[model samples]
Target: MDRSPFPHHGPLRPEQVTGRESLAVDLAQRIADRRLTALVGPRRFGKTSLLKRVAADLAAVGPQPVWIDLYQLTSMADFAAAVDRGLASVVGPVRRALDSIAATVALRIGVLGVELTRSPKYRPDPVLSLRNLLGVLTSAAQRHDLFVVFDEFSGVANIQGGAGVLRTELQHHFQSLGIVFAGSEPSTMRALFSEQTQPFFAQADLVEIGPLSDAAVGHIVEDGFETTQRHTGGITSRIVAFAAGHPQRAMQLADALWRRVEPGETADMPAWEAALAEVRTNVNAASERIFSLLPTGQQKTLRAIAAGGSIYGAAASALELPPGSAQDAAEKLIGNGIVRRAQERLEVIDPLLADWLCRRFPI
Candidate 1:
């Protein structure tokens, strides 16, 4: 309806964002206050998009925000290098911004981190290297206040005692930089900050990034349809409701429905239903492909969660499962973005997938 078919192929840019205005303002405030905030939610819930938008806003206000995508980095060694690269554009242009000699911190970060990448002969102090890197960033922060955001950082940021060390050190030494740890995996994020033994324990405020409401998404759909002079006729409301407010899927299903409509035409109930079936069929098939790949008890757990039942063991039930097994399955489910913890209970994060699971495997 928007002529571009909702653009769900990737995350939207800052100007392209619709709704979630209050969340944006809150994040901006936390960043400016130099408070560490964990942005946690399910995948494709717009975490990266919000981070990018916040980064742009932080830069505008004079804190030189460094956005580092840690998705490609699986280890602390990789983090040091990627972080240096992320800051190179801003920190590289100057020779001696700080009082120290330019030669002191002028080394290309990749080269400094190269030893960690070597096969056999490499021996380097990871903690010292990380300290030096942070020190350099601290020096740069003097000129331009630093707002560092590690996007999708769970991969490397959960390095057991290693990340804990970094967090402790930063809290002690670097008070000038505002750091934001953001990821799409809700379970992992919760464990990172909520667990008493974890590195980031109780250090940051937890911001649960929930899905957009049905009515809000409806407004978005109507706006998109109006741009193309097409009438939505309540079809968008149905699609958004089916999508369960997950932003990406809602937009994607809306896009899928729009493809069935001719130019200058409004979608009626019948046309919308047909398109919904087509979209659901594709989603179900894709989900089934991975269904067998999950752990043995996981399918049962998925069906249980989909059907709005407890995944834990029950003395009164034959489908009862061990607590350890249930927790394992829950971890995988949350990691895959299929389920998330809503307060104390677990629920399917994707509504369409939940409906599909319920219909295909009623428990």
Candidate 2:
């Protein structure tokens, strides 16, 4: 009833009644026991949010919690620098624990001569720097039991095989430090951690986050709209259905609808329609950028698959590309996390993304 549709920043908490309490508690227990955990889900399904909540709960018990988003990192050095920055921000005992490493590592702020008041200079290798930092953290954890959550872990894939190496090293050196890995790209993360060829194979418990239930979605919408005196009705239901239980989309749509509501006026169907249209537009822009990066044959193959409503051979001949080309492109799309294949049928990962592909490709 705060008149704001936006939920709290970071992650939603367990008691938030957002319908992820069971999973949050499960993750909390795993971290508490010093177990590594991987939380995987489609984009905006609350993977990061759930992990943030778990981190908060863990912090409440003892060991300080540190949250890092790998997406913001481009290389191992960047990741290490980020870890240093994140750890330096920790206060009290956690801050003191990092002091020694910070001195030895000589961590700095940036290219400009900015030093971390009590922090160390930035190290060149993030994995090694993190390894050394974890050594200090492990010693501290023995006294305080720290929890570290790495969000958007899928970005580690972009780190030139550093993902595999980092996972292996962390598993070896920091088993005592509680670790929670969360990523929007579940399939990619699974391949990294579950695939036998990868370093993290079966190294951590895998937690797949699915869509929220109708009741949970309803609660979030109702509570969000309550501040504006808007009753939960068809409008909320339609929004939820449109989001298809995606937590990020649901929150985003709610935020949009709230902004559209005039003072003392309830949100109407037109507002929902307008919001969906905007979402579609944004999705289209993103998809177009990705599609443009593909080769001509790959683009044609995608269109053909979209037109045929499947990736099976029936559509191959129409695209004028070789059957193998279409199949290969399909694999590439799936591997790049741009498309999803299930039951031998291919579709864009998100509904909004699918709508964009349908509009641009127009098969």
Candidate 3:
């Protein structure tokens, strides 16, 4: 048993046992077929990590997979620049197509004046350029296929002022190419593609990335923590309970507990408590900041939701507020990744945040 610490951040590799094999396989198939796919989940649920794993697998099968993190891009120009950088890494016919467009557009590289040999300038209107670039890349790589994944796509929509228009435009331009759009907010993601009024309605298949099952979590605990302690099941169960099925939180809790327990020693109640405390503290601070930003009515509605054990009927009864107010506030919170409606109940996206809110406004 190797006593190595697990990575706290970044993409999870195939060697890692995160229990998302089904998702990876599904996404791989979609990419192989040159179909569009969308992954929806709450933040810290491993959306990005799962996509990276699937993307790696897709690239292995021949089509080059390029990943772009839309969170880093604030403006259209920034988004274009990031795409250019990502596309530059791709080779073969895709590279030729991009280069051809670069030559035709006379696209200049930034102040570096490096020219459009590999990277093109970040244009304010990157959609047109990206469309042209994708046209060439797709046409050139038609034989092999090219997969492009946009992570944090909801953030990109916010940057473009709602996902409606941008999703339509991107769907029109790149839906033909193998592409996957993933985001932590399911409501926003659904609105983009599932809603008929939206641009991408029914354009791509909707794939929900759910939590790792108990059995899978046990495997991850045993393998990733490198312990043959035989109590992997119990440890994994406790970790899942603490994280409430959020992948990132589960991993973080496991990592914390693993670090606290000494080699050859089994994880104990004390260590678990300590780890839980740390997670709660971090989540509380974040929830507090977000709660502070809400209007008085919204804050009251949230408290009522928490008191009622969910947001189902809290506004109508506990808060005595208009139904639309609650709905609107909930939508806003969902878009911001602060809250989500699941299992017919509205709750904080993060379990830790729920705990934090509970403590602050006790019923």
The reply for model 3, stretches above 4 Å from the true place, is 1-5, 91-128, 159-176, 195-198, 227-233, 307-316, 320-324
Residue range 1-363, candidate 2, lDDT tens digits? 354665634565544535888997898888877778888776667777677666667677765787666775676666665565566667876677567545565643232112222234552445555565555555556566677888888877777766665665465545567888888665678887888987778888888787787778777887877766765446988877766666776777777787777656777888888877876766676777877899987787667655546545666777776788878888877666666655566765565655666776664
RMSD (Cα, Å) for all candidates, in order, is 3.7, 4.3, 4.4
Candidate 3: worst 10 consecutive residues by lDDT?
108-117
Candidate ranking (TM-score, best to worst): 1, 3, 2
lDDT of each: 0.73, 0.68, 0.66
10 residues in a row with least lDDT, candidate 1: 93-102
C-alpha RMSD (angstroms) for model 3:
4.4
| Candidate 3 structure lDDT | 0.66
Cα lDDT tens digits for candidate 3, 1-363: 444445657666655635888777888888878788888877667778777777677666676776666775565555555566666766666566656656676553231122223334442355554444444445544444667888887666555643443454455446456788888766777777877776677987888877667677666667665643423425667876656666676777787778776666777788888978887876676788878999876787677656545444644556666777777777777676676666787766666666777788887
Candidate 2 at residue 56, lDDT? Answer: 66
- Record all residue pairs in model 3 with backbone atoms less than 3 Å apart, i.e. clashing: none
lDDT of 1 by residue, 1-363 (tens): 235648786678877676788888899888888888989888788888887787777677666677666775566767666665565544433323422422485544545656656653574556666667677666666666677887886776445455665675577634678888888766677777888988778988988778988877888788777776677877876877788778988887787777767778888988888887877887887677767787767877787777777766571144567777777787788877778777787888877778778788865
